[model samples]
Target: MPSMTVRNVPDEVHRAIRVRAAQHGRSVEAEMRHILESAVRPEGRIKLGSLLAEIGRKIRLTDEEIAIFKSVRDTTPARAACFE
Candidate 1:
């Protein structure tokens, strides 16, 4: 295991961490670890075209309208394919 030290923390921030840790039945160290994990985790990008299409479908956009949007703002197919 790696040892780490974090300095220059404000008193209020420490109190907030302790409160949150108690709320979740975790020690301050464990809460900090969880926070770090979530903050540092990688995330995938959302496809604008597909997302727009889904939203369009939900809102009952016509096929023609959807096609127009797909044509005008379609991302480069190569970069889009990488997401899948």
Candidate 2:
């Protein structure tokens, strides 16, 4: 395993990290390692719009219900996708 050192952290930050470490039942060193690992990890999250669109296709709505939904959707303009 490799080694690392962090220096000159503020008192407030150090206190907060200590508190958080205690809350998670971990040593400060272990908590810091976990935080660093998580920062580098890729997040696996689907875009809300794409997820909603997929669900929309699977379910059928009445014309009036769709009209109401469309009216709500119109409030938020969709952003242009990079590929288009």
Candidate 3:
């Protein structure tokens, strides 16, 4: 796993983080990781797979249409573009 160094945090902010960590029964580092993860990837965000599934449901695709899609779909791994 990778690690990060955050420098020059204010004393008051650090204290708040310590208190919050204790409240959640986690170490300060774990609390910081949780906070950062939540900030970047919130719970209510729309995911691509869920959106596609919803669209399929709304359109009421039949079994034959789904079979056609599966038959024509490419299953091969995509090659990376060469920039050189």
Candidate achieving the largest TM-score: 3
Query: What lDDT score goes with residue 68 in model 1?
Result: 91
RMSD of each: 9.3, 11.4, 4.1
Q: What C-alpha root-mean-square deviation, in Å, does candidate 1 show against the real structure?
A: 9.3
Q: Which residue pairs overlap in candidate 3's backbone?
A: none
Candidate 3 clash figure, as a count: 0
Please give the lDDT score for candidate 3: 0.96
Per-residue CA lDDT of model 3 for 17-49, tens digit only, reads 999999999999999999999999977899998
**Candidate 2 residue-wise lDDT at 68:** 88
Candidate 3: residue 81 Cα off by (Å): 5.4
Error of 1 at 29 (Å): 0.5
Off by over 4 Å in 3: 46-75, 81-84
**Order of candidates by TM-score, top first?**
3, 2, 1
Q: What is the lDDT of candidate 1?
A: 0.88
- Once fitted onto the true fold, the runs of candidate 2 whose alpha carbons sit more than 4 angstroms away are 45-84
lDDT of 2: 0.88
